[model samples]
Target: MAKQDRAVRTRTALIESAAALFDSEGYELASLSTISERAGVSSGALHFHFTSKAALAEAVGQAAVQRLEGITRPQVDDALQALIDVTHALVRALDDDVVLRAGFGLSDSIERVRVAAGLRDKWQGWVEDSLGQADREGALASEGAAQDAATALVAVTAGLETLGRQDEWWLSHAPLTRFWQLILPRLAEPSRLDVLVASGSKGGAPGL
Candidate 1:
């Protein structure tokens, strides 16, 4: 039991170290030796858990996916508000979590050849579904606006993620709040606009 626990700790440390390295340095530039050293584990232990860099990256991507799934899986009363809250939470996660940052970075990198799908794809799907729900509930201003709204939201958030890689200011909630402030009035019904919080709601989702 102790051995298994120790093994789990070692694997977790390696994944975290690799994520930090991958987040700071591009995947091609991050070396397994450095990851292992950062984790305070031997190269042999890293090799035992992951035979190749691709395998380790795949693990990192999977870990990131799990974190994202947690963020997007909650059932909220207001779908549009849910989308707003999620975007806030996601930006926060991207800014604060190395695993999420590396996962997104790896998802776009050539090293993701072994991974199934990127985090952006998952986020896009969630955005579409959330907006679809909002439209069904008559929360949207018009019938066909969901598609365009989804596209704009995805593109803007993607841009934020990209810009956030260089400047931390882009990752802050201010830009996203401003985005929602400007776009929500156009997308949501006039009656709903007053109730919706562009800065996001505090009740649901602990971090956001």
Candidate 2:
């Protein structure tokens, strides 16, 4: 039991160290030796946990995906609010800078390439499912184009991450928040539901 516990600790440390290094330096430049050194574990111990750098990278991606799945998997009661919630959760999930840098930005051709590819597919499917649900609930306007719109949403988020690294200017200029805000209104008819923020005292338009 003690041996197993120690192994688990070592694997966790290695993954964390690898993720941090991958975030600071691109995957191509980061090395297993460096990761092992960072974790204060011998190279042999690192190899026992992850046979190769590719394996370690794959584990990092998996860990990140697991974290995101937990945050974004809630059943959204209000379609409009659901998207908003998803956006908020996604942004928060990226708070760990390494997640944005290594999980999404880096190439995923690790030893477990299939597993990495599955993660990408899972993301696309999740987006499609969420968009489909919103469309049914009259929270989105893509009627005939929900799939395309969902794909575009994914693309934009990925692009924003890459652009965010290059310059802070993109952070404010990017229309991520606005894009969703604009789309949310178009998804359903105006009178079907209140578009503006609800208040105790009525008489104001939807707060834009």
Candidate 3:
């Protein structure tokens, strides 16, 4: 049991160190030796856990996938409201979590032929599903607005994530709040608009 726990800890540390390096420097630039040094593990230990940098990169991506799952797992009573809160949560994550930023960055890397879908792809899919649900709930203003809103939402959030890497202000609550305030009115039915909180839920994003 102790050995298993130690292995888990070691693996986690390597993933974290690799994620930080990947975020600061692109995948091609982040070296295995540096990742091992940052993780405080011997090269042998790192090899025991991940045979190659590509393997380690996949682990980081999979870890990020788990986090994204947690973020999207909890559902609010209102579908549109949930969408607003999720966008807030996702941006906040991009700003705060190096792993998430790195995972997303990995998705953008042309060098890597990743086995799993990119984080951006995963996020866009979720946004589309949420908007579809909102339309079904009669929360949207029109029949086809969901697809349009999904595209805009994905583009805006992806832009914010990309820009936020340089300046954190792009990911802050103000920009997202303003975005929601601008678009929610147009996307939501008038009756639904009054109830939607542009910033987020009164409490916070679910599964936080």
Candidate 4:
């Protein structure tokens, strides 16, 4: 039991260390030796857990996928509001979690080698599904506005992710708030507009 626990800890540490390195320096530049060193583990141990850097990267991507799944898990009552909440949660994760950030970064960098879908693709699918649900709920302003809104949301969020790489302020709730405020009037039914919070549920709260 103790040996299994130790192995689990070692694997987790390696993944985290690799995530940090991958987040800061692109996947091609982040070396296995450096990741092992950062994790305070030996190269032999790292090899035992993951045979190759690509395998380790794939593991990081899987970890990121789990985190992303948690973010888009749809916990709210309203579909539209759930979409808003997901965006807020995703930005927060991207800002704070190196594994998520690196997972997204690796999605683009190692597209050919990756066996699973990329984070961006997964996010876009979620947005599309959420918008479809909103349309079904009659929350949208028009009949076909869901598709347009999905495209806009994906584009804007992808842009934010890119810009965030340079300045973390891009990942803040302010920009997303402004975006929702501007788009909600057009995307949502007038009746539903007032009920939807653009800045998110956590916005305006102390220390948020």
Candidate 5:
């Protein structure tokens, strides 16, 4: 049991180290030797866990998906509030979590190569689902507006993460908060407007 636990830890370490390098150095530029060295593991051990850099990247992507699931899986009574909350949590996650940043980076970076669908797709799907729920609950001004908001939100999220790679301020609370402030009013019905905050709910997800 101890051996298995240690192996798991070692694998996690390699993934995290690779993610950091991938986040900072780009996937093509981050070498296996550096990843193993950063993880404090032998190259043989890295090879034992992952046969190739692409394989390692695939693992990183999968691990990131798990984290995304953790953020989006919880069911909330107010879906629009839940949407605001998850977006806030996601931006913060991108700001701080190298693994997540790398996962998103890798998704965009490795698009031509064959791999799983990108994390953005998953996030966009969740956004669409949340808005759909809001429409069902009569929180949205109209179904069409909710769809437009979903597209804009996903695009803004992708753009923010891209920009945040160069400047942390893009991922800071103000950008998303301002974005919500502008769009929420147009997207939501008048009665539901009071319930939403562009900055997110105090009762929301992990970041806030």
Candidate 6:
């Protein structure tokens, strides 16, 4: 293999191994040696790819964010819908134990504080933008409540994550449906909520 490809593969291996270990053992208890051994690479190679366990944890969190972005980027139709869609998509992606661990662990890591803050800002931005669009499109029912809705949406999703299952990894379709049922009707074109409900997809986008 080319040197670059080989290096990338090794990095992938290290990240995957570290994600699994961190998920199962928690960040403090998971060791570099265990991750390096699981990846079948020398500690030196692991160090070359990621300088420390905290670095590896940050990488895992970043990877989880990337995976979620892939599923959600095209799924949002407007601001509120985008918030709903992306939040749902994110919750769905957490079906994996590694993602669960990374997300759960992100809350407690001082080393990854910047990453956590960036993630929060990203979500908040998306929510605010979507609400702005919904207002432009005349699809917002609560005329002056965009900011409040965005904040509430974030809070609700966080609560859902805390309340939901930690193991077994799949998104609970039933709970998701219930959430939609409750939120969709509050929109401007309240009757057209069926489009989202029937499609079971966001943004009414194909290939999502």
State which candidate has the highest TM-score. Answer: 1
lDDT of 2 by residue, 1-208 (tens): 9999999999989988888888778778889999999998999999988888878888888777776676555543655455455544554345444653467644465444445545556667777787787678766544665776777777766666666667644444234556665554555446644652221112111111
Identify the runs in model 2 with alpha carbons over 4 angstroms from their true place: 107-112, 167-175, 192-208
lDDT of 4 by residue, 1-208 (tens): 9999999999999999999998898788889999999999999999999999888988898999998887887666689988988898888778889998888888776553373347788898999999999999999999889999999999998788889999999999899989999999999999998789997765322123
- Worst 10-residue lDDT window for candidate 3 reads 108-117
lDDT of 6 by residue, 88-181 (tens): 6666655544654464556557556445435555656766777777778777777776766677777766666656545332356566657667
Better of 1 and 3 by lDDT: 1
Q: CA lDDT of each candidate?
A: 0.89, 0.64, 0.86, 0.87, 0.87, 0.66
Residue runs of model 3 more than 4 Å from their true location after superposition: 110-116
User: Model 3 over residues 1-208: C-alpha lDDT tens digits?
Assistant: 9999999999999999999999998899999999999999999999999989989998898888888887775357788999898888888888888887788888865355262346778888899999999999999998899999999999999899888988999989899899999998789999987788898986547533
Compute the lDDT of residue 115 as modeled in candidate 5: 37
Model 2: which ten-residue window has the lowest total lDDT? Answer: 199-208
- Per-residue lDDT of model 1, residues 68-144, tens digit only: 99888654689999999988999989899999888888887644534525788889999999999999999999989
Which residue pairs in candidate 6 collide?
79-130, 79-131, 95-169
Cα-based lDDT at residue 19, candidate 5: 91
What TM-score against the true fold does each predicted structure earn? Answer: 0.96, 0.78, 0.95, 0.94, 0.95, 0.81
The ten-residue window of minimal lDDT in model 1 covers 109-118
Greater lDDT among 1 and 6 belongs to: 1
Pairs that collide in candidate 1 are: none
Q: Write the per-residue lDDT of candidate 5 for residues 82-198, one digit (tens) a residue.
A: 999899899998988888888888787555323324687889899999999889988989759878998899999999998998899999999999999999879999998887878
- Report clashes for each candidate as comma-separated counts: 0, 3, 0, 0, 0, 3
TM-score, model 2 to reference: 0.78
Query: Which candidate has the top score in lDDT?
Result: 1
